[model samples]
Target: MYESGEVAIPLKDRVFGRYLADDVKTTEGKVIMKNGEYISHEEIETIEKENITSVRIKSPITCGCVNGICAKAYGRDLAKGEPVNTGEAVGIIAAQSIGEPGTQLTMRTFHVGGVASSSAEKSNFESPSDGKIKIQNLRSVVNQAGSEIIINRTTELEIYDLNKKLVSTFRAPYGSTLLVKDKAEVKLNDLLLEWDPYTVPIVAEEIWHFRF
Candidate 1:
């Protein structure tokens, strides 16, 4: 619980019979569940449909004092509590403070002595919107191992709508393995690239013009 008498819990961890500390609303500002209402299984399903990841629930008073004494001391309801401000990113802030230090310490220990270590990196691109991919300036070469490897380093992946209007553009990180072919249609959450993120990132400052 935070100082404001509320705790943010992830949707998956939320328990029934707990009261809400604030109004739960949809992305368009329509209220799904009002403040101080007890969470029910039906409410949980409704929240899931809206894609809400977390919610603030009222924190029960645990001052460990005599029943009426604590209520009088705090000058608030013994059962219900004050609403926590939704503007505060309490969940994200707490996670960074608690998780970053451990992650940094673990990353440092990955490279002990002279051995190269694999660092965590994003190895794939998931499509954010529905569109067709348009690949440009792509160049590759076959290695002695008979594997095709991208070498241009400056190739671009552009997303276009059915009307041929460009919607978004992305540049593949150097040495990334391409997954989708040019003019391939894609939908949301579709995989676009399977990058070699475990290896040291290769950078090329100049654009290449290959003739093959």
Candidate 2:
């Protein structure tokens, strides 16, 4: 078993000025004095209270100020050590510490694409208009997306600029047809749908572009 100190002394002996050379331990190797504390009257009292009879002193108990507590001097003399992780909640702290520079991002509008409004009559498809018309409606599928996407008769579309800033949202109005169902793969040239030129199609582009 590990003993308290290297040299044993009787409890009655009063070594007035001394330094604990090594960590004092119980007979079973439990630590007592942590090896560097200045042996002061207070420490002695504590040792006496714990009934520790003797303590080992280093080869030299080399401190001039034995009259008072040497803790301040010992602390100054102590070397700096690497930081220890206390298993703190670092993720929470990091999240909180992050600063948000501006106000809330994103527009208030939301859109659901590929759904035509219910108010549009299917009979509108019977008559043909002179404008260029494209016919397919499919959605671009993402790898992680599910196999099914259900689009009702109404679909909403939110448009954003290249900067990812929200520009506007479009909900399929009356007289529009929904050509694509859920989870369909579509490309840029794929037809979104036939647009009523007299109404919302190029007229929309004209209004946006200020083309009369």
Candidate 3:
């Protein structure tokens, strides 16, 4: 219905008696109209019932020096956002690419206060088997609570059964306090070590109010 030379038009604005430029098919591959078929009121009603918004109509037949095939190829290129002419500058293409909606993602990040990114804090290490505990490479200091807090990173705790066979090995991070002494007997799931998490809890020891 538009006065311009545009081939595709909205289905509501499509001119009756014009020919279909391409085949129109349903989503299930049923042909609604074949290429070059004349569009009449019946065809328009059928297409509208199919919920088609736009349709391509055959362009006016032209004479003279114009190559219809070449014109169609250029039209397809223009529709696809491809450069219509050779030697198009790369900067122009880059600008066009950046202007697309897909390239406009926000760089903003969101974070919740007081939520730690680390995994769940482990406060205690339990013995994995019934065995005697043997400590190695341990350097620790006894706290006021009479707990031996390991200060070294290389400490390895080994568990050996009654036959002196190694049952399991355990390592605790620095600042971990031993719950069982060296050569202490422990059963499976028994407490072997304990430590506070790396992150401290936020506490307000004193309350003060300020008017803003």
Which candidate number has the best TM-score? Answer: 3
Residue 177 miss distance in model 3 (angstroms):
0.7
- Superposed on all Cα atoms, the candidates' RMSDs to the truth, in angstroms, are 15.1, 32.4, 26.9
**Best model per lDDT:** 3
Please provide, for model 3 over 1-212, each residue's C-alpha lDDT reduced to its tens digit, 9 standing for 90 to 100: 21111122455554355556789888788988988676666887998899775677654352122533223222213335432343334346647877644444554444444644454556777887887999999888776677777776677789898778998766666777778888998898998887666543232223456698
Per-candidate local distance difference test = 0.62, 0.40, 0.64
TM-scores of the models, in the order given: 0.35, 0.22, 0.39
Model 3, residue 97: C-alpha shift (Å): 20
Worst 10 residues of 1 by lDDT: 1-10
Which ranges of candidate 1 are over 4 A from the true structure? 1-120, 142-148, 201-212
- In order of listing, the candidates' clash counts read 0, 7, 0
- Return the clash pairs for model 1, or none: none
Of 1 and 2, the candidate ahead on TM-score is: 1
Candidate scoring better on lDDT of 1 and 3 = 3
The deviation in Å at residue 50 for candidate 3 is 73
Model 3, C-alpha of 86: deviation from truth (Å):
34
Over all chains combined, what TM-score does candidate 1 have?
A: 0.35
